[model samples]
Target: MSRNQRWDFVRNKNLCYCCLEEHTVRSCRSKRDALLHSYQATEEAGNATTGSRRPPAVLFHGGESSKALFRYIKVQLYGRNCYINTFALVDEGAACTLIEKDLADELGLDGPEKELCLRWTGEISQTEPASKLVNLQISAANQGATRYDLKGVRTVAHLDLPIQSLGEKLIKSRSDLKSIPMPTYRNAKARLIIGLDNIKTRENAIVGVPLEGRELEGDDFVAVRCRLGWSAYGRQCSGEASRPRILHVCECNNGDRLHDLDEAMRNHFALESLGVTVANKPLRSKEDERAACIMEAKTTFDPEAKRWQTGLLWRYDKMILPNSYPMALGRLRCLEAKMAKDPALSQFLMESMKSYQEKGYTRQLVREEIVSNSNSWYLPIFTVTNPNKKKTRMVWDAAAEVNGLSLNHALLKGPDILVSLMGVLIRFR
Candidate 1:
């Protein structure tokens, strides 16, 4: 950010706190000085941090670089840890914005320690700004005049097979990368993976909540992480101290309510004020995550399409909705979810809160598509390994230190894959 930009944002001191502009009431030097009878603007801004909220983990997937996203969020949180993974690109586009719309989209060095240049930064939405900047590109691509545009969410190949048919298509080892039969993509696109691990998240925690054989067995549902420390930075911000953080204050669901989420995210997170088109059975979360190498999330929503869409996005902080409701309303709902954490996700033990309001929890299954050398590979959640096959690392937690069970081909392909996996679980902190 430039020195002038900081001054401009600081000049307007009555804007919304979430806006993260220099134009907040607390940002005005005169007003700030008058209120506190002191002049510690830099120090004050320096000490600010995002309140207790876990913003979604951002993974930048574009043909360009971004900076505005980080700078804006930094000012928003004052000073908090928001984990971000930036993927540098030679081409410039805004594919990443769809997922990281809450962040900025700039690519360059602001030169030296001038973090104040974020004078008028705003939460970027492709629905507006630079006009045909995205439209023309998309139009051209569709017409074959151009090569790529962030529009027209990429085409996904979804194929459903009988459980037995899927069982026979398994491929073993990295060397078997080419042996797997896979579909193809004409170009890149926005993607996410939806996996139904017998897991649950209560109070932003991940745990195991299995089922005998059903969709989302009973009451368990996935919850967005509300608080997390920034592990590393994809790039550096000027005059930076500690890495930045984010706080999400969104709303989510208890189980598979696919239809509800679809409606909510329609015109909500879409471009040109247009509504989001629903795509069912688009492969699986694991496949999309591995094949696309972009931002991905996993959740379990109802299969009825029009009925319920409560899958990966359940328990999200819906604070950014049109109305200006107290952040607490959303918080309280998530609080209810927290009380319902599963054992695999939450290290914090609480036996009384097993089922969410006695609804019980059910497990969701997702297929994974892996990629190596620009090709695709398939693996079901409960993959049966061949004894002669090598090993694949399997973890129950996000933290890498947690020792997890490995896939032993012989036994996995022999008797029961899921049952054998249960015995290999390693306790972790």
Candidate 2:
């Protein structure tokens, strides 16, 4: 429609600006249908390329329905020209350059020289190893396909979509920029993300909108930002603000001196454990406390050997159970306690013993068999009803000793016993 006719429709007859329809813009069905089709096409194309998609000879351009725009550039790897699809973003806070494995394989990049440990990406707190680094020349955008040499680029398996930091410096330098379009992807694009390692330290806390607190859940602490870009709410560590007012300082001794003495003592213990011949000297002066500390314990995993080793002293004989509370029945006292607790349990026990006899878990002992064996270990078998199922379950208490030795101590306990048999409770703040 002409400008004069459009103005006449807006002044005389109320109509939508988008489609010049009689209804308001809020009720525009055509726009909604177009958006729906765009999203559906993206999903269908992604699903179709699951197994048998051909390699792209040129860069893919981001369409109108895309969340972020993309650019395709020619990358020179190993004296050959290769096309790489990439997302050019405004900001990619504190990230390094990364390349995907598939592109690296196609480009004939070598195996990884060393591991790359990445940190601080949503829910990914662990370090991930990267493949071998390679040097490449990538065609610069808006510079008429001018090639620039980029070195030490690392490759990873899932580095398909990379957000290249673009208007970050512009936003920082210019206060006028309210929001910038950050590059993202719904499907595979660029193999490499440039300028990731160029990240700088950000402010401790960003200025946010007013927010309300919610009921806390989950074990690990997480900082959650609201939809309004306001103050985050999640589990946070108790700081000085949460601490009590009362405080005390004792001038007992120098902490550095105490630490030195402790380290010297540990080194001595380690040397003794190794059976090294050394002179035992009493610490006479402050100079004696200044000795070097023992090296910290190290654990190493051998990928080839498929085993883990720790530089810790082996203590095969001694056991370190968390809690060591005493039991009610001990050393042949179990049978008498069982009889006193419940006599019906005795009848159930006898029935279970008969069943055990049939199953060969337990057998009837003849007089000759008893006489032939000088040392006998008599273990009590008991039964208890499960509350949930209301069914009787048998338990062999080998720890009920005949001659003061516990078979339970000698053998490894179960997944249940590990929890149930604990004598101490530890609570972390």
Candidate 3:
């Protein structure tokens, strides 16, 4: 039939031209089906190009799913006498690797004992005294040609990984994850933990691939490829009403500064033996005497101002200071930029500097003085704040070095003149 005749026939029959249905062409089911098919084809093509599919949505049992996932692998640990194959957890969050104490003993591994404080989840703490540390070699259970050495591996009583077992049905369904070797029925116990020390090393790099579109009994997982071997880690659904258990272990050296404490105690007791003993006067070197004589000659008291003025005690009479004007100018420009951003800080700094000037602590340099002093040092100034007291103080940085010398380095260090606190307290009593 012609186009006009077909259209008229469809209109007269009250049917859709696209599907020959009773509805109009605008609401035809065939058009919607065609669009849905096209979208599915595009998604399939994208998944094929990426060699992975989108992960399936998790199927909740009752209200919510509390399944936990952890990285675990089968490894062969080589000890002194022989080697043992066991499951190990790869935790990059852990600072150090750990092995089961019983397993360590079985392998005849021995090392120096150390005291460590172990902290676990739920604010639990344990002090492990004389904990043995050992060195071991580890390799993949399937591939043993390449081995990685783990040094200073700590020993723990037990390493528990409370994760559900991976069934063979899940592995057989996915081709990409079929290569991963896992236990048959029961979940293997994780007797060892490989920490960040091994995972971060270039020799033992690890890569992870999410096992998308691979779900069995509402469980999702990811496959990890490392120097060890292919391993699977993800949420495991047990169809039970229980919370997931995750193990997080941290260890630190327990009171390693006992030797320093013992030394301090000995010194305190020794001081008690010499009661009311007078300290000998410190002997002055020729440099100290010269510096003292120079200070005495240059120092003068102003009767009107009620203040004393003195010149800097130079280490050498002929040594000239390097020009620090450029450094000081750069620092001042940086400070100005910062102060522009904070008005309160700028006001505080100005007030502090004005106070210093009023107390005769600092003086403004004249144009003639700056021109004459070509090789003079410039002390940079900065502000420090006490957060507890909510107070700001200005500091003059005399320790800023220029050309391997600073103001502090050029000046002479006088003899110790500070009185002991114990002597002062005794005299007051």
Question: What TM-score goes with each of the models?
Answer: 0.12, 0.25, 0.43
Please estimate how well model 2 matches the true structure, expressed as its whole-model Cα lDDT.
Answer: 0.44
Global Cα RMSD, each model = 41.4, 30.5, 27.9
Q: Who wins the lDDT comparison?
A: 3
Instruction: Please give, for residues 1-429, the per-residue lDDT of candidate 2 as tens digits.
Output: 655555675658776655666887787855432311345667678768875766556734333321222232223333254454343211233245566667667766565465665444332433345556776554422234434454566666674343322234423432222232222224334455554342211222221212333223542222222211211112233321221211111111246557989999888778766954535753333322221111123557778757665442222234332211233235236656776788877777678778878765567778777541322234555666899998877776756543355545544321121332333443111
lDDT of 3 at 52: 67
Question: Which of the predicted structures, 1 or 3, would earn the higher TM-score when compared with the native?
Answer: 3
For 220-251, candidate 1 gives per-residue lDDT tens digits of 21111111111111222222233233312111
Local distance difference test scores for all models: 0.26, 0.44, 0.72
Residue-wise C-alpha lDDT for candidate 3, range 128-228, written one tens digit per residue: 67679898888878654577778788988766666455668756766656755654435667888887666644444342122333334434755656667
Q: How close is candidate 3 to the true structure, as a TM-score?
A: 0.43
Please identify model 2 stretches exceeding 4 Å from their true place. 1-79, 88-92, 121-123, 126-130, 141-143, 160-190, 196-429
Which whole-number lDDT from 0 to 100 does residue 108 have in model 3?
Answer: 92
Please tell me which predicted candidate would have the highest TM-score against the true structure. 3
* Model 2 error, position 346 (Å): 99
Q: Using TM-score, rank the candidates from best to worst.
A: 3, 2, 1
